[model samples]
Target: MAGRSIEPFREIGGRLALVRKAYGLTQRQLAERVGRPASYIAKLELAERRLDVIDLEELARALDLDPGLLLSRLMGKDPI
Candidate 1:
């Protein structure tokens, strides 16, 4: 089977990093809020890790975002 594309994850990671920064959060801070390790957040932001739905939901909650809205924004679809 072909490997999954990394481009989409890169985009999401970029958006996630931006959002986290906008909230004045460091990787460590976000990781603490999400109950993950700082390295997990770092790897995720670097696109070296992919987020499953549960992970996404936890992150969205930590970021004070709605999971659907966060997903939409990450996908470049703003539901404003």
Candidate 2:
């Protein structure tokens, strides 16, 4: 899932971790803002669970990132 798929989970997780770090947030903080379990954020960062579109959008918004940017980065396209 990380190295082979078109949406490589490692890349996605890396990007997500980057965004969270850039925002100076912890997994628990991000989870509270997005109303998700902190373990979910940890799982995402670890590439243990795939995030759905709705969850992605919510996370992007919560992190104050453009949803398009999240979509683009996650899809391996140019950042928005």
Candidate 3:
């Protein structure tokens, strides 16, 4: 939420979904890794919610991705 201008969360959500699925993780599975509820991941993926850097870090850790790269992807800079 800081450092960069707020990007459209709908786009971010779609990227997040792509990365999560690429890792072959279910919403529940990714949530377990991030210590969140499946519904939380579901909401984020559906663009019903927003993501902060901390949340992105947790997901990157779970998916073996770099947080910056993930953020870049969300910002429409680089691909995941």
**Which candidate's lDDT is highest?**
1
CA RMSD, predictions in order? 2.2, 3.1, 3.6
| CA shift of 50, model 3, Å | 1.1
Top candidate (TM-score):
1
Runs off by more than 4 Å, candidate 1: 73-76
Clashing pairs in 2: none
Off by over 4 Å in 3: 1-7, 74-76
lDDT of 2 by residue, 8-68 (tens): 6666777888889888999999999999899999988887888778888889989887766
For each candidate in turn, the TM-score is 0.85, 0.78, 0.79
lDDT of candidate 1 over 1-63, digit per residue (tens): 159888767777887898899899999999999888999999988889987788888899898
Report the number of clashing residue pairs per model: 0, 0, 0
Q: Is candidate 1 or candidate 3 better by TM-score?
A: 1
lDDT assessment of candidate 1: 0.83
**Worst window of 10 by summed lDDT in candidate 3:** 1-10
